[model samples]
Target: MDVIYVIDILGTFAFAISGALVASKKEFDLFGVIILAFVTAVGGGMLRDILINSHPINWIGDLNYIYTILTAVVCTFLFKSKIAPLRKTFFLFDTIGISVFTLLGLQKGLSLNLPAIVAIIMGMVSAVFGGVIRDVLSREVPLIFKKEIYASACLTGGLIYLLMKQIGVNENVNFIISAIVIITIRTVSVIYKLQLPKIKDDIFTRNQ
Candidate 1:
């Protein structure tokens, strides 16, 4: 398998694990967990593919995606207790997945010769939409709604990758650098519990 393809499958499975955890927390049935896993694994890429007209979608043309998600979900379920204690490690995998998918999205957009703006948007979409779906399924407001810099990190990585290409840097080095930037930002944020301040609710503050 191509290196990129292998990364894509690993990314898919890691996100599936995230979704399965949420489903289990919600007391969802087996079928619901499967749906959650599949959606969290492929929803973002599918959305990006559709937007870019990358047709037939991703998981559809590749049954391996299904098998990968299934395996991830079952294994996650069997070891849920152990896995719960390793949230940070799983998040490392999730961040890697985000970086890989963002790069792939930018590549796909640029393959069509899309403008830099569009490519960045595609990259952000590819990275975060799956998390959005996962949050909604778990009955939580999606993180992107309040915006604590998750999508910003993806866009920053995409823009950096594009800048390096424009400057004629080695493509492989550019990829490594961009992915590192993303993972670093995500890791720091998680370690520090960093989040943008929420706008305080004040419905009672009326000028009557």
Candidate 2:
């Protein structure tokens, strides 16, 4: 199997687990948990493929994706107590998911001859939209909109990937480097409590 394919599957599993963790935190029942997991695993990819007119969609054409999601949900369910305490584990998986999805989406857009800017946007969408959906479903503020360094990391990684490609880097090396850059950025941001500046309350009040 291709390395990208493997990365895609791993990303699916990671996102599924992340979603399941959220569902469990919200005390959702089994069915709701599985549904959230499935959505979080494929929602972004589905949107991306639809936007690009990729035929059949990804999960629709691949049973393995479904199996991977189900497996992640099951594992999360069975080990909720143990896993819930391990916040770092969930963060790690979520970081991996975003990194892989960003690269995969960027490559897909490029393959379809999209403009560089559009491809970068696609990469950001693929990396962050699933979590947005998950957070919306969970009735929480989405991290991407809340001054977090989530989508920015993906954008940075995508740009690095493009720059590397332009400079004649090997495809696999570029992929690895991009993913590493994203993962490292996210990890450091989280660990160090780094965040973007938020709009001050006075800015909104002044208009009113």
Candidate 3:
């Protein structure tokens, strides 16, 4: 398989496993797990494809995406106990997934010869809508709105990817650089507890 396809499949698996783990935490039944896993693996890609008129959606054309999710579910079930250290593993995978999807989305938009702003939006949609669906289904606040620097990180990375591509950088190297930029930003922010400013409670109260 091509490297791009391999990366895409890996990203799909990681996202699906993350979704299933979340469902398990919520005490969801097997059916719920399957639904969440499927949506989380493909929802963002589907939304991106739709927005770009890219067609029939990816998983619909290839069973690989579905099988990837199924494999993730099975692996998660078997290795749940051994996967504790995988909290960080999953986070890294999620970051990689975000990067890959962002690149994929931007590539699609650029293929359509879209404007840069529209291409970035496509990238964000491809990277984020899956998590949005997961949150809605799990009855938790979505990460994008939780001030965790989630989709914004992807947007920033995607923009950088475009700029690098514009400078005639090779596509493969560009992807790695973009992914590292995103992962580094997210890791440092979380590690240092860096976040956007919050309205002080005193200020809000005085205003009211």
Question: How close to the true structure is residue 61 of candidate 2, measured as C-alpha lDDT?
Answer: 84
Model 1, residue 102: what's the lDDT?
A: 93
* lDDT (Cα, 0-100) at 48 in candidate 2: 89
Assess the local accuracy of residue 130 in candidate 1 as a C-alpha lDDT between 0 and 100: 87
The 10 consecutive residues of candidate 3 with the worst lDDT sum are: 195-204
C-alpha lDDT score of every prediction, in listed order: 0.87, 0.88, 0.85
Q: How does each model score on TM-score?
A: 0.89, 0.90, 0.89
Which residue pairs show backbone clashes in model 2?
Answer: none
Candidate 3 Cα deviation (angstroms), residue 88: 1.8
Over 164-188, each residue of candidate 1 has an lDDT whose tens digit, in order, gives 9999999888988998988888778
Off by over 4 Å in 3: 198-208
Ranking by lDDT: 2, 1, 3
RMSD of 2: 3.0
What is the Å distance of residue 10 in model 1 from its true position? 1.8
Candidate achieving higher lDDT, 1 or 3: 1
Question: Model 2, residue 24: displacement in angstroms?
Answer: 2.1
